[model samples]
Target: MNYFKQILRFAKPYRIYAILNIISNIFYALFGTLAMVSLFPMLNVLFGKTDKVKIKPEWNGLLKVREYSEAYLNYYVTQKADQGNDDVLIFMVALVISMFFLKNIFSYLAMYFITFLRNGVLKDIRNELYKKTVDLPLSFFSEKRKGDTIARISTDVLEIQHSFLSILELIVREPLMILFTICAMLLISVKLTVFVFIFIPISGFLISLIGKRLKKHSDKVQKEQGFFLSIVEETLGGLKVIKGFNAEKIFNRKFKESTSRFYNYSNTLLNRQNLASPTSEFLGITVIAILLWYGGQMVLVEKSLDPGLFIVYMGLAYNILTPAKAISKASYGVKRGNAAAERVLEILNTSSPLQDKPDAQEKRDFNTDITLENISFKYEDEYVLDDFSLRVPKGSAIALVGQSGSGKSTIANLVTRFYDVNKGSIKIDNTDIRDLTKESLRGLMGLVTQDSILFNDSIKNNLLIGDEHATEEEIIDALKVANAWEFVKDLPKGIETNIGDSGNKLSGGQKQRLSIARAVLKNPPIMILDEATSALDTESERLVQSALENMMKNRTSIVIAHRLSTIQNSDLIVVMQKGKIIEKGRHEELIAKNGAYQRLVTLQSFD
Candidate 1:
């Protein structure tokens, strides 16, 4: 219930809908009890047990209104009997039908209003979850599974809707229905109703015992679902690898294992949750049977209760069972929903370690060099950048050549502040990158990675991400600069062609060219090319290298170089081994030293 109240704050926007639903529920409860109680007059008339009133019943106080109502009905029926009206029973039946009709109408109104509140809370929570997923630092995702996040946003939220938020239906309509029915039963015979109260608490306590372990099982079921979903997500993303390694059987076994756990957990949870309904109903019937024995004695043996009113009392007593059953089921739902609420609130309540300070402002442009001074950083226990430092002058192209895991790419990540250093600071034009707003700091640079991250959208839309208001001509010009215009114009739709998922419709080199065109469109003062052309064949690499040179013109560039020959003409070349810089100089100066750079060039046969 505490978890439920936390999520209820989202209903503030739709408070009017909730209020209207409560109002409708109050009427529905009133009408529902009246509908059952209306059966008494019909029963009395059918049994010919009604009394003939000699005088009209006087208006009595509220407490005795039930007696006055019965007295008035008796006088009307007796007058009709003396008038020789054969439609008296027909009129009574029609009145009963109208009471039932009004009851259903208000019941529908309650559900209709509650629909808005339930769905509105779902929309707001999912939107906030998605927003937080995007805003949290990338490091947050490193320790979590993507499918678990997807489950939190999709399945867990829906579970909360069904279990937690849907409790609104049970809280108002069902409880009030029980209250009204109980009150009506008291009016008919307070003695029988009092006997009912003593046993109901014991029944309620037993029903609650089923829900005690349900929450723990439900959490296990939800987590198992997330595990299987993660397996599916991983399998889809790695189909090519699975086929390449001929490990399809291995991954299939992994998926099967996760699904098997899911099956067991879900069955255990659902079967226990299913027990709540029958247990409550079975207990309710036991109470009803006991009421029959006692009430029958009061009427038949004791001669203290009337037969027709006792029949009405039994009808109203049965009415309470439906609501009691509903309440029992709802209690189980709340238990399950509590687990989902905890999962959802976990994301919403997490404080991001990466956020701009209150005094931060947008850094509009770059004017001077980028300086990395003795920056030390570690991802886990080991330092990836051990007291690394470098000075990249404005408009100068610096190429980084190193073996894999030599911390070349880490420099790109740090300069863009995708990560912050543990010990030292990076400055752009003498201002610490941390002091600048992340958005504006990143806006001053362009990044083109080796993987060529492109979306499934039209080529024009993809290019427009670099410049939203770019005209068609601007897109064509940027493509030409990327050496991609020739291939794009040959396609059927030219700039309007839809690139399939991750631009799969385009070839590797074409995708790379389009990626470069996106950065070219941005035309930032600084460019970071993280092995942008490394994955291409010789022909594709040559064309992409040409495009890279064109984009690097008049820009300060940091090139994480993969091909040794490509960076021979760079203004400065730095060779790295481990996390330390082993050599730094012009390409020719390093080649003359017969040092690490020269050895790597010989290996590539670029000397």
Candidate 2:
């Protein structure tokens, strides 16, 4: 119930729809009772028990509304039949028909109104989850699989919508119907109704006991599903590697094990959930058998109840079982939904590590040098940077050159605030980046990694993400500056061509150039290139580096260079070893020093 209350907060904006759904449910319950009550007069007509009492009689009490409505209906039918157009039996039949019609009509309205609230809440919840996922720190993603996140967003959230919300409707509406039906049954025969109460509680206790295990099994099923999805995502992302290593059988075994466990958990959950229907039905029939024996004597042997009245009481008694069964099924559904809801809320409830402070200010521009003052960072147990310090003037290109794990890329990430430093400060123009709004700080820098992260979207749309309001001419000019215009112009649709996922449709060099083009279009004051040309061939590297240098001409740039030649003309080159800078100077000075920088340059010269 507490979880449902938390979920209902998403419905606040659509409260009007929720109110309308409740109102319609009220009418739906009324119609359900009225439709059952309508059977009484028809049974009377069939048994030749029509009354000649005052038809439109008024009343005052709890039953007054029911009595008045019955009287008004009786009078209208009798008045019409007095003209010899129809018999009293026909009028009673018409009342029964109208009751059923209103019953279904109100039911439809209730469902329609609830749809608006359910779907609106679904949209809002997903939107908020997406925003939270994007807002969370990069370190959070580093610890979790992307596919598991995808499973939470797509499959798990939708399951909650289907399972939880559907049960919520039944929880609210069906119980009211059951209550109204039981009350009417009591009016007919309190003795028989009291008998029903005994068995219902016993059945409910059994059903609840069975359902206690459902949430546990459901959680296992969902967890396994996430594991399988993670495997699929990994396999697809690294299909080339899998094929190269001939590891298909190994991955297949892993996937099969995960799915097999999922299958067992699903079976456990479904078997328990499926028990609700048959268990409730068996209990209901047992109660009815008892009533048939006891109430039969009341009708025939003792003359305690009329046959027609007994028949209507049986109908009302049966009505209670329908809603009771629905409730049992809904209870199982709620348990299943709880598992998925917990997963979804796990993501939604997680607080972002990098969130704007209440007093955070938006930085308008960078007017001075960028400084890393004795900055230190660690990823979990491994320290990547230890007391690292560097300074870049307002518009200077500083290239970092070192071995793979020398913390070159970490510097770029730290400067962009992708991951917060463990110690010391990163200041832009003397203003600590932490004090500025994340959006404002990020807006000032453009980043291009080795992967050239591009989406499966048209080239124009990709460029538009850099500056959504950029004119067509500006997009084309940016592409030209990145040396991507030649290939794009040769394509069938030019900038409108769709680049496949991660730009797999483009060559390695083409993807990097397009990436550079996007950064050029952004036109940020600071550019971070982390091994931007590392993945390309010699010809492509030359073209990409040319465009990169063009873009970095006046911008404050941080380059993590893999090919030594790219940073030869760089203003400063910092050589890192372990978690500290081992050398720092121009390329010529590093060669003169003949240290780690000199060894790296000599190695690249041979390659």
Candidate 3:
């Protein structure tokens, strides 16, 4: 219930629709009760029990209001009785039909308004969930499956809409209908209505017992759904690897195992949910059967209660059954909804560690240089970079040459503030990067990674991510600067060409070059290239290396280099080993030293 209350806040934006729905439901309940109560007059007319009255009934106080109303109705019916019983019967039937007609109309209207409120809340929740997903730090996702996040946003949200949102209708309509029906039954006879109340609590208790474990089962089913979805997402991402390794049967068996659990959990949850309706209905029938025997004794043998009124009381009692069944079903829905709301709120309530400070300044420009001072960081336990210090003077290409696990890429990540340092500070022009707003800090740099990260979008649209308002001529110029225009100009749609998933439509070199072009379009003061050409073939590397060289000119660049031949012209080549710089000098000066740098050059020459 606490989780449900939290989810209901999303309904605030559509509160007007909620208000409208409540109003319509109120009328629907009123008319629905009246439709059943109208049976009292019709029964009296059918039984020929209506009596004629000569005098108009006097207005009585509220205590005898029921008697006064019955006298007035009898006076009117007696006037119509002179017309014929057939005509009076027709009028009574017409009155019942009108009540039913109005009840159904309000019922339709209640559903109509609720549609807007329900879907509006759905849209708003999904939108907020997506925004939260994007805003969370990368480290948050390190321990979570992508498919679980997807399931929370997609299926779990839908479950909330179906289950929790239905409570809005049940809250107003069902209880009001029951309240009105109970009031009318009390007007007819308080003793029998008291008997009806006794069975209700017992029925409610039984229904509750069945639904007690529904939430636990529902949680298991949703988790299994996420598990299977994760397997599918993994399978799609690594389809080629799976085929190359011939592991289809392995994945198939894994998927089947997950689904088998899901099947059992779903059946258990649904069977419990399905039990609510019949259990409530059977309990209601049992109450009804008891009322018939007790009321029969009072009417036929004791002659204390009227037959027509008892018949009407039975109709009103029967009217309580529909709403009771609905309420019992909705109780189960609320339980299921509680489980779903917990999953959704888990994401929404997570506080990102990377949030900017209240007084964080917006630093938009890069003047002077970037510096790392005694920075220490870690992803989990052991530090990836410890006491790492470096400086990049403006407009100089500083290349980091290192063996794998030498923390070259870790430096790139720290510079970009993708993950902040555990100790010490990274400063731009002497101001700590943490003091600057993340947006403005990131705006000063461009990044190109080992993998060419491109989306399944138009080539033009992909470049627009770097500069959304870039003109055609500016885009073409950036492409030329990255040496990508040659291949791009040959494609059928040229700049407008759609690059398929992750730009798989382009060759490795073409993809890498476009990534460079995107960075060039931003034209930032600092650039970080993390082994950007390592995955390419010889020919592709040559082309991409040329593009990198062109883009790095006159810019402050940090290059994490793999191919020893590529960074020979760099202003400073810092060779690192085990997170520490073992050698630092220009390429020619390092070659003259005949030490670690020279050894690396010699090894590459042999390769």
Candidate 4:
């Protein structure tokens, strides 16, 4: 419920709709009761049981207003009949019709007012969920499925809109309808009204019993939905791998298992939710049955109640059933919405462990060097970088090379502060990296990673991420330096062509060149190239390696590579084994030392 109230804060901008809705619903409830109450006088005059009034009724105290109003209406009917209008019965019928028409108009207005608020809250909540998802650190998603996150933002948000907003309407209009109906009943006969409510508590207890487990079942259903959606997400992302390995059947079976569980949970929850309507209606009929018997005694056996008024009381009594059923269904809706609200708030309330300190200063320069002093880091129980240290002075390039799992990549992760060190410090220009704002720190460095992370957007838009307002000449210059402009200019749309997902439409070398072009466009002071040309064909490698060399000119560069050829010309080369540095020197010095660096070059020569 606290989470639900937090969601409601998004509705603050749309509170005017709520106010107008409430005003319309007040009139809606008013006319809804009076529409039925208007039937009594018509029935009285039709049966010729009218008490002829000889004088006009005087103003009476507020407590006696009902009696005084009835007397005045009786006097009006008598006067109209004595004046030979002969349309007294027709007037009563017209009055009842007009009351119903106004009741429906107000009902329509009430719904019309709330429509925008409902959709507005939904849009704001989805926008907020997406904003928070992006703000969270990458490590937070390491333990969460992408599909489950998508389900939270899409499916769960829609569920909240339906259940909460619908129940919000129930909380207002339905109860007021019930309140107004009961008030009319009491004016007719307080005794009959008091007796009618005796069985309401029992009916309410039964309805509450039906919904006791709805929230638990709804939570189970939502979990199953997320699991199935995750399967779909993984399947689409790995379709090529699955087909290459002839593992389609295995993935199909897993998806089927997930969906089978989803089917079972959905049926159980919806069936339970579906039971609320009929059960409440049946129970309501039982209450009306009991009210008819009790109220019949006052009219038939006791003769204290007017036959006409007693029939109108029965109409009002049956009227309570509709709102009662609506309330019962809305109660179930609230239970389901609570489950979805819990999921959405779990993401929104999470605090990122990586945030810049309030006093953190922007780093605008890389004047001297980057220093890693006795740094230790871990991804799990094992240390990935233990007691490791390195430095790259301004205008120099340092290369890290080792066998896989030797923590070469972990150095890049730590240097960029993607993951903070568990111990010691990484400093830029004599300032601890943690003391610098993350945005400004990253702004000073450019990264080219193993995977080509391009969106399914036009090439021009993709390049614009490097500089949102880059002129056409700067974009062409960056592409030419990265060796990407040759093929781009030959394409059907040149740089305006749309690249497929993750640059699938382009060759491996082309994608790498585009990635490098983006970094070149940024033109940061420090460049980190992590195996930028390792996955390409020989021809592609030659083209991309040339681009990388052009991009690294006169900048501080940290290169992590498996290919010995790529790092041979680096100013300083460090050979690592099992998270410890074993060899560090110029390329020729390491080869002369006959250490791990020599063995690695010897092994790569055979490949």
lDDT of 2 at 495: 92
After superposing all C-alphas onto the true structure, candidate 2 shows an RMSD in angstroms of 2.2
TM-score of each prediction: 0.96, 0.95, 0.97, 0.97
| Per-residue lDDT over 126-149 for candidate 2, one digit per residue giving the tens place of the 0 to 100 score | 898898898888888887988788
After TM-score superposition, the amount by which residue 221's alpha carbon in candidate 1 deviates from its true location, in angstroms, is: 1.8
Clashes of each: 0, 0, 0, 0
Error of 4 at 217 (Å): 1.3
Model 1 TM-score, all chains together: 0.96
Ranking by TM-score: 3, 4, 1, 2
TM-score of model 2 (CA atoms): 0.95
**Residue-wise C-alpha lDDT for candidate 4, range 91-136, written one tens digit per residue:** 8889999999999999999999899899999999999999999988
For candidate 4, report its TM-score: 0.97
Clash pairs of candidate 1? none
State candidate 3's TM-score: 0.97
Worst 10 residues of 4 by lDDT: 80-89
lDDT of each candidate versus the true structure: 0.90, 0.86, 0.91, 0.90
